[model samples]
Target: MDVSKIHGFNFPCPIRFGAGASKELTDYLKANKLSRPLLVTDGTVAELSFFKEIKNDLQQKGFSVEVFSEMHKNPIKSDVLKGGDAFHETGRDCIIGIGGGVALDVARAIVLRVNHKRDLFDYDDLIGGDKYVTEDVPHFVTIPTTAGTGSEVGRSAIISEDESKKKRILFSPKLMARMVFADPLLTMELPPFITAATGMDALTHNMEAYLAKNFHPMCDGIALEGIALIANSLETATHRPDVESRAKMLLASLMGAVAFQKGLGVVHSLAHPLSSLLDTHHGLANAVNLPYGMQFNYEGFEARFDKMADAFGLSKNNGNRVVDHLFEMNDRLGLPTKLSAIGVEAKHIEELSELAEADFCHPNNPKPVTRADFKNLYEKAL
Candidate 1:
C-alpha cells in the first residue's frame, strides 16, 4: 500500500495500482502479443497531455493504436456501437479504456458488442439478456483517469437509449477487464470541481451500498472501509492533491464499485434522471441530492446510519449526525448543497420522479421507494 511504489492486487479483478502503473501497458501488450489496440476515452481526455503521451508512446513502441472518442458525457447505445465499429474496422486485437467512467463504460460495452450481434439494447441485463451473451469478447484493459464510478473494475456498462434517454444495464462476467492499470498520477491534475464531485460519487456508492437491502456481510465491511477512506482524504484530495490523497481516493473509488455489488439505492435513482434530463454531470447530481436521499432513508435505518457516522469519525452514533455531516461536507468541498443551485426547478420534478421510479437502483434500497416518495425527495431537495 505505498502510493509511491507499484502494488498488485487481485480481488474482483487484477489491478496494478500506484504512481507509475500505466507505464506497464507496452510491456503487457508485447507479452500478450497484441499489436493493435482500440483506445476508448472521452473527448476531453482524448485531448489531454497524458492521453496524447499514452497514444504516442504506443506508436513509438511500434504498436498500432486506434482511438474512439465519439461519446456523450452520459454514454448512449450509439457510443458503444461506434466504438465497436472502430474496433472491427481497424482490426483491433483488444480494447483499452483510458479515461473515466464514461470512457470505461463505452469500452466495456464495445467489448460485448464485438461478438454479440443482436440489437444493443437486446443485451440489457434488466431484461435477463445476459443469457444471450454467449460469445467471447475481445481482451479488455482499463486505465482510469478519474476516481469516480470505478467503471475500470466493473463488469457492467450503463448505456442509455438515444431517444428516450432511459438507462440500460449491459452486464456479464465476461465483460470484466482483463487487467487494470490504476495510476494515481493520472488523477493528480484533476481540477477541484471534478475531484470534489467524483469523490462525493465514491462516497455515495459506499454509503448506499452499505445500506442496500442485500445480505452480503462482506460488502458491508468493504463499503464502511471505503467510506472511511473518503472521509479522511476527500477534502485534501480536492483542495491540495498529492500522491497519497489521490491514491487513496482512487483506491476508495475501486472499493466503492466492488462493495456496490450489494447494490445502490435512492441517491443514484435520483441522480440518474438529472443526468438524462438536465445534462448535469452524474457525480455532481449525486453530490447535491445525496444528503436528501439519506435523510429520506434515515427514518427506519438508524442503525445503518450509526455505523456510517462511526466511519466518518463522529463520536455519536446517530443518523441525524450522518445527514448533517454530508451537508457540511458538500459545503466544504464548494459543491452545491441544494438542487436549485444546480438548475433543478419545480417544473422538472414530475418527470424526474417518474424516471427515478423507473430506475433500477432504488429497487435495492433498504426501504421501498415509491413514485410519491421520489416526488417528495425532489421537492425537499429543491
Candidate 2:
C-alpha cells in the first residue's frame, strides 16, 4: 500500500483518500463554483494546527469562509440550528465539515435544516420525517480529522433533544457529502486516548454490523474485512502513531460506516445511553460496553462469533476467545475495562437499561435483546 499517495473511491460516496487528500479541497470547491463556505467543526479541532492550515489555505485562495465551532461532544438540535443561522446570516453557499463525529453530524444536520425549515426534529428520520426532505441542500463536503464515527461518508446525523437528551436520527440520501477528503495525515496528531477510544469505536461498528440479523452479504463481507484491518492496526495507531497505521484505521472506519448500513446491534444500544445519560464520550462509551455486549451476543450465536474470531486470527470455533480478545484489546489500548471506572454507578443502571431498551439499534441483533438482558449486561459490566 503506497500510503504516501492519494486514491479515489466511488463506493458509498465519492472520496479522495490517502495522505495528502486534503490538499484537493480548494480545487473541488472551485470546480463546483462555490466561493463562500461555512466551516463547521468542534472547538478542539478548530484550535488544532492542521485545521487552521486548512482554513488558511481556503482564505489564501480567496474563498470567503465563515466558521461555526460552538457544539457539544454530543450534538443537539440547537447546534444544527445555530449553524444554519450562520450559513444564512453569513451568505455562505456551501458547508464543509472539518472535525470528528460531532462536527460532521452538526454540519450534515445544518445542511438538512438550511432549506427544509420545519421544526428541526420534525425532520427526524425516525418518524417518517425524511419524506419532507424534498428541497435541495447546499453543497456539502467533509474532511475527517478522526478515524471514529466515520460520519464523513455517512448520510445521517444523530442529533439529540437538548432538554431530554433523547437521540433523533436526521437522515436522507440528499444529506450525503458531495465529496470527502479522508486524509490520514490529519489524524497523525491525535492524542493516545482519543486514538484508542476511536479505534475501539471502529471495531464495535464492524463487529455489530457483521452480527446484525440483516441479509446483506455484501455488508457482511465488508464488515469482516473492516474487523481485520482494525485488529491489525489499532494498537499501533493508539500507542505509536504512523501514517500506515492511521491510513488503515481510516479505511477500516469508513468500511465500518458503510457496512453498518446493513444494521447495528446490542453494543450501540448499550453505548448510546452512556453518551446521553452520563455525557460520556461516544467512542469511550462504545469501548467500555463492547466486550460485555459481545459476551451477551456470543452464547446463542457461536458460529457467528467464530467468524469474528477468524477475522481476529484466533484459533477456529472458540467463540469465547473472540470475547476475550475484545477485553484484552481495551486493556492494551489504555481504555477502562469496566463501567465503574467511567463513573457509572449502580444507581444509574435502571435508567440506563431503560434507555438501552428504547434505543433503535438493537432490533437488528441476531438474537432478541430484552430490557432484562440490558439490565444484566450493565450489572455484569459494572
Candidate 3:
C-alpha cells in the first residue's frame, strides 16, 4: 500500500504514520533545526536493529544523538531525575522518545525536569500541579515501537514515586510530542504475548474513555471506532503480524490515547497498583483486571457496555455479552484470567485497593469507586 506515502496529519501535533514512517525522523529533526537530541528508550528496544539503524542514520547525517536506555519498566521519579542529569551532561537540545509507555513517560518527565526548579511531583496532575510546569521544554519527538499506551500522542506522563510506589501523572500541553512517527513496521517483530497484552490495553483505553461520563463527543466517536478496529485486527496482529493488521493496531492504539484525553476509568485505576507493587507489565495488568472492572461498572452503564458489545460484533447488544466477549478474547490471547496467576496474592489486595482508590484515574470513573469497591474488584479478578 506504500504506507510511507500516506499523508502526515495533525490532530494537535504532526503525525507521520504508516510503515517505514520512522525513516523520516532524520529529516524531521533537521527541519526543526534540532541537531542535538537525546534518544530515550529501554535497554531492550535499544538493542533492536531499528534503534541501531536510526542512530546510525542520524549520526551519519551529522546529528549529535546521545542514547539513554536506563528507563525502568515502571518509570520512577529517580529515573527521570537521572535522565535529566544525562540530558544536561550531554548538553542535548531536544528529546526523542523511542519506545513504549515507560520510555516515553520517562522522556517526557526528563523534559519536564530539564528546566524546572521544583521537584517532579510538584507537577502531578492530581493537585492542579500542572500549573507549576511553566517553563518551556526541549523540542520533543516520539517514535513508538509498540501499539499500546499511545504515550507518543499523549500529553501526560505517568511516573511512579520511589518511596510510595504510587504512580503520579505529570501533565502539560508542553509535554505533548512535537511530532510522532508511527511506523507499523516497528511493531512487526513483537512477540505474540506482548501483542495480545498491549492490544488489550488499547481496548481498555477506548472502552474506558467511551464509558467515562464526559461531554466530549469527539472523543466518544474516536473511542468507538478505536474499539472496533482493535476488536477486528488484534488477534490477527498478534498471530500473523501482517502489514495491514499491524497498521490497524497501531492506529487503534493512537486513537485510544487520543480518545482517553476525555479520561480513563476503573480499569486503569486498578491496574496502576499492580504495576507499582508487583512490577507486573502495565498492559498485562490492565488485561487481567479489565473484565472485573467492566463487571463492576456494567450495571451503572448498561447502554455504554451494549455499544461496546456491538463493536465487538455481538448481536446480543448487552453488557453481559460484552463481558463474555472480553473473556473469550482473553482466553484466545492466552492472557491470565486471574490476577493470582501473575503473582498478585490475597495478602496484597488490601494495599493494592488502597493505592487504587487514591489513583487519579479512579475519580474519573463513571461509577464512583471506593476503597471497598477497589478491594472487591481485586478479589473478583483474583
Estimate every model's Cα lDDT from 0 to 1.
0.94, 0.93, 0.90
Backbone atom clashes (below 3 Å) for every candidate: 0, 0, 0
Candidate 3 TM-score versus the reference: 0.97
Model 1 scores a TM of 0.99
Candidate 3 wrong stretches, greater than 4 Å: 1-4
Best model per lDDT: 1
Model 1 — which ten-residue stretch has the worst lDDT? 311-320
What lDDT is reached at residue 199 by model 2?
A: 88
Instruction: Give the 10-residue window scoring lowest on summed lDDT in candidate 2.
Output: 315-324
- Return the clash pairs for model 2, or none: none
Better of 1 and 3 by lDDT: 1
lDDT of 2 by residue, 69-88 (tens): 99988998888889999999
Q: For candidate 1, what is the lDDT?
A: 0.94
Each model's RMSD to truth, in Å? 0.8, 0.8, 1.3
